[model samples]
Target: MTAEIKKQKHVGRWVAVGIVGVIVLALLAAIGWYFVRVNPSVQQVETIETAFPEESLRPEAGEGDGQPVNVLLLGTDARGEGDSLLTDLGDRADTILVAHIPPDRESVQIMSIMRDSWVEIPGHGMAKVNSALAYGGVPLMVQVVEGIIDQRIDHVSIIDFAGFEGLTESMGGVTVNNDIAFSYHGYDYPQGEITIQGEEALIYVRARSPFSDGDYQRVHNQRAFLRGLMTQLMTRENLTNPNRMADILATISPHVATSDTFDLGTVASLGSQLAGIGNSNIQTFTMPTLGTGMEGSQSVVHVNWDGVEEIRAAFDEESMTTFEPPAER
Candidate 1:
């Protein structure tokens, strides 16, 4: 009986040690997750707000409640020695777009504003929309766009052309529906259904020399690329898989510069709502332009206000419904 009791005590001690070990390991794992995942996400949101101050213009929390939010997305090609970001003194706004996420978060409306189109720059006089940024950075760009559309913008996310590779590669390349057959940079892109790799998508939209519409067709191709990108990101398979998430995060991390107002928690919640939305629910259009002209040495395109106002009305129904001042020469 004494020997049996000793064996039982030894076994009990070992079992207690194993239980403590398991608990310690679990505690360590939770701490690791909090630091590696949750903390960085929170930091990302705070960093975004610090980057752009325009986020304050968003309707107050209760005012719009769950209404749609507007984001100004800039895809800049000004990547040189000192002009990598718009922070560079001479950088121009290459791509200007307004993305609207509705209250339900179920749908999104993306309106692309042509960079070269001429419009009134608030502090400065009339000039090409792209020139607004070169004049006064994000502030001037926001002022001009808001003045033209008569709507308050929520936030801004600026990404480089190089970032395109990350996005295309994240989804293992996106499939774009080409309207016509074309060749550029020694690569032939056929019409109908086609899959494009990271490098291919870059050259596909960057091809402006061969197209008849020139910049006009380039804008159209951009719209097509965005459509494909959104479709791929929101798919059911991509959202739930860890491998896809890692690729997406890797692709988005280095290339994206967003306004400080974006909350990661909000984005996490919004992602689920966005999954239900489709391309059909979203609207995409470009600002009207009158070819190109020379403002002394700069080649710029004049804005066609009539067409722009028509599209603006759809977003800001309260004011932009009609063009009161009308277009001028």
Candidate 2:
């Protein structure tokens, strides 16, 4: 029954073992190759400027990883005509978004604040919310936002047009649903689905003059663009390809400036924590407002105090699941 049969069985087992070992080695090699290609570009993230507001002025943040985190993201136009972002920290920001991550990190929420919202800016008196940046740089901006939300912001970032271009280009462009067709800056943007990259991306987001609703429609467009951008970044194509991700981060890093504590490692960890999130997990909306009204000679957006209180409750509860932004007007 026999010696030959036993010898053949042993040979088969050895061959199977060899095949599994080879497969494991090949998988490890592939992972190492991917890491080598993308890691250098990730290091570029560390190069972005870090400008944190003074701790004395910042609202108190809850300690430990179990608490929620709020990050203030500002997009400025201070880099025009040979100017630089660092030299013009007091420039009025056109884009103001508060990015919130709940304790579980199951999803990301981006809330766009109207630029001309009439809000109390500490020592500056009642003025446009955007003026907080222009009146007192990052510190006052932080204070004003914290006052509005009544919650501590764990981090902040300021990006200019260059950064916007890099983000769109790095993703090879992003597609957003254009609700209104409008010609802007010599470029005609048709209504419907469109993909824009580089400078066109910035122009697309910045074009609000063509709309009747003005900043109201502009904020909606901004949220749409951001939703599209994040969806592209989270795609399997970019996430699985180290070279693609490297190219993206390399382009974006130079133009972005974040708070000191929110470095590349912290960002990467956030990415990891939210690795499985898909398009449905991301939320982008504008903060509720009472439409635009005149406050003396200047026009400004009126704050919906009731909605603000609702948001504060959501923040304290660490869940935006029930949060509802006001209908677009």
Candidate 3:
């Protein structure tokens, strides 16, 4: 975050925050709709429970860095949803992702760090990266992810899956391309394009048991959902109706936790900056891993340190636009 006001760029794509960006992008692209008046009682953004990692542990950069900036986004499985999670010590972040916006602001790159990927926690020994949330709330989650990328996280936010229920309902539904046919939560998702809304929408993104590849496919589904959501928001139906768009965005506020510095004004500006980034400009991939194995009595994903170095180099050079993710394991 910037030293002056800690204004980290809003992630152009995130399950929770990502959807919000599309909302902003759609609004910004529409006439007289970019300026959203957030109801104080229903603001979708909130300050995290814990402060960021100690300054010493964070990389020195700010809003002025002109360097690529990173935002950490956590998606939970429902335990201690939203701000309540600040005090819910047992809650673990189920989805861990880093959204990188290059200095040019011409494109966005989303890197998903598997929650099960074994990594070093600040004060704890190696363990599932998600465990960092359980150990020290948002602060530790930010610390662990930063350590992996070797960069300071300018801002952090989280959202619970439950929030998507209302969020999806507000949009009528979102459509995504399904690669595998699967029945989940009593709903049959065919191997083709389908529209999902309400409870089924949540079921679609959270269904991993239906895939042999498990979370691997689930993360892919998450990105697909975001892709569809962006299309829905950009539809003339939503962009033309300011009231409808405002209410749809509000449905997610109670379920998201972001830094207090993440205000609507800043969000609008970033939205304006990223207004031109279409789905093609927003790329998604997972951190490289050798494979999964027993890291004791527990199964864990092993990080590909060599691949990580390549990723670090890509970030350093602001060449992520041309970077290719490692082949899936």
Q: Identify the leading candidate in terms of TM-score.
A: 2
Could you say which candidate leads in lDDT?
Answer: 2
For model 3 the local lDDT of residue 302 reads 93
Candidate order by lDDT, highest to lowest?
2, 3, 1
**Superior by TM-score: candidate 1 or candidate 2:** 2
- Work out the TM-score per prediction: 0.76, 0.82, 0.81
Worst 10 residues of 2 by lDDT: 43-52
Instruction: Tell me the tens digit of each residue's lDDT in model 3 across 1-329.
Output: 56544333333223568778789887666644334344542454566755588888887665554677688877775544344745563445667788887777767777888878999887889999888877887788888888888887876777777777778888788888888999987899999999999889888888889888888898888877876776566445655455776787678887777876556655545656666456676777789888888977998889999998887877776545666666667
lDDT of 2: 0.78
Per-residue lDDT of 173 in model 1? 83
- Clash pairs, model 1 backbone: 48-259, 48-260, 49-260, 49-261, 66-103
Clashes of each: 5, 0, 3
Model 2 bad stretches (over 4 Å): 1-57, 80-83
Q: Which stretches of candidate 1 lie over 4 Å from their true place?
A: 1-35, 38-62, 79-86, 293-298, 317-329
**Taking the tens digit of each residue's C-alpha lDDT, what string does model 1 give over 136-250?**
7776677677776666676777777677777787677888888879998878999897889777888887777878767777777777778778877777676555455655665
Worst 10 residues of 1 by lDDT: 319-328
Candidate 1 local Cα displacement, residue 241, angstroms: 3.5
Model-by-model lDDT, in order?
Answer: 0.67, 0.78, 0.74
